[model samples]
Target: MVSVVGFLFATQARMPDHLRFAFRILTLVFDAWPYATTGKPFHRLDLPRRIDQVERWKRSRLAFRQGLIAFYRSFVIFGLYSELSKQDADRGMRAKQD
Candidate 1:
């Protein structure tokens, strides 16, 4: 999931300006959160920790945070589903080969 998002951002030239802007905002908010005294970015966080933060913010009353969370979440789910489907297809092929 992280790899997909990272790839999209790393290749920002291929993405529309609006989409890039949304991603930047999402990243800013995510990274700016105070995870600990070390002040490391959210991308440095483990998957489970990041998920916990997203779940917490999703339930918050702040509309901006919720919107960002929703946008971020859509990409995550898409990446997860896409990867899962590909893995399933690969598994099926391997099974057929046996």
Candidate 2:
């Protein structure tokens, strides 16, 4: 999750000015959502704190909150699996060299 944020920033250098500005604003909202509900700054708290909140939010009757949880979960899960795939590929290549 943190790596995704960093990768976005590193690529931002090549993005258009307007897109970069929009990305910054979107990042602020994503990072601030937890603090808005939980009162703890995102950097100071463990991610499980936010994960628990999102799990509760997923059970909410409101459509928007549930949708948000679904969307966020998809993104996080995809990133995690992608990282795992990369790690497996690297391990395979290293084994071939030995």
Candidate 3:
């Protein structure tokens, strides 16, 4: 969320008010997609935890944390992209063997 906000703030000074508002709305939709399902407002909801709540709750704190980590992991230097590049290189090398 901070990253998205930082991006918005960095561009705000030069961007017109209307465009900035649109940018803000778009960024919010990306960030809120996971929690905004089931047609409910999730920001104020208290999530449940434990076995009984697994299938019944909106989202537990653990899931929120994990999802956030996964989101950042995709773009981090040594995360998804790096791993994907390594896999691609290995596959190319193996293909040469045949």
Candidate 4:
């Protein structure tokens, strides 16, 4: 998640201030919304609960809500694959060194 955020902000550095501000607000709402039902922040939730929350957002009736999750999901998936490939390259380099 941290990596995703880092990648998002780093890649979005040139985005308009208003759009970036909106993204930050939406992120806070995403993390804070779960607190109403679970009495815990989104980050503090267990894996199952976290998945459930994301699923809820993905299935939300609001178009913006659904879009928010979609945006986040894309970054997350991309970040995961990128990290995996990086690790693979590092491992291959180490193997060659040995």
Q: Could you tally the backbone clashes for each prediction?
A: 0, 0, 0, 0
What's the alpha carbon RMSD for model 3? 12.0
Q: Model 2, range 2-52, lDDT digits (tens) per residue? A: 475465445566678886676566555555777867786655568888677
The true-versus-predicted C-alpha distance at residue 22 of model 1, in Å, is: 4.7
**Candidate 4: residue pairs that collide:** none
lDDT: which is higher, 1 or 2?
1
lDDT of 1 at 93: 100
Candidate 2, poorest ten consecutive residues by summed lDDT: 1-10
**What's the lDDT of the predicted structure labeled candidate 1?**
0.73
Comparing 2 and 4 on TM-score, the stronger one: 4
lDDT of 1 at 7: 48
What is candidate 3's lDDT per residue for 1-98, written digit by digit as tens? 23444543554545788866765664454445446454433343356422222332224455544443343333343444556787899999999998
lDDT of 1 at 19: 73
* lDDT per model vs. reference: 0.73, 0.67, 0.49, 0.85
Model 3 misplaced stretches (Cα beyond 4 Å): 1-8, 36-98
TM-score of each: 0.64, 0.58, 0.28, 0.77
> What RMSD does model 4 have?
2.8
- After the best TM-score superposition of candidate 2, give how far the Cα of residue 7 lies from its true spot, in angstroms: 6.0
Query: Clash pairs of candidate 1?
Result: none
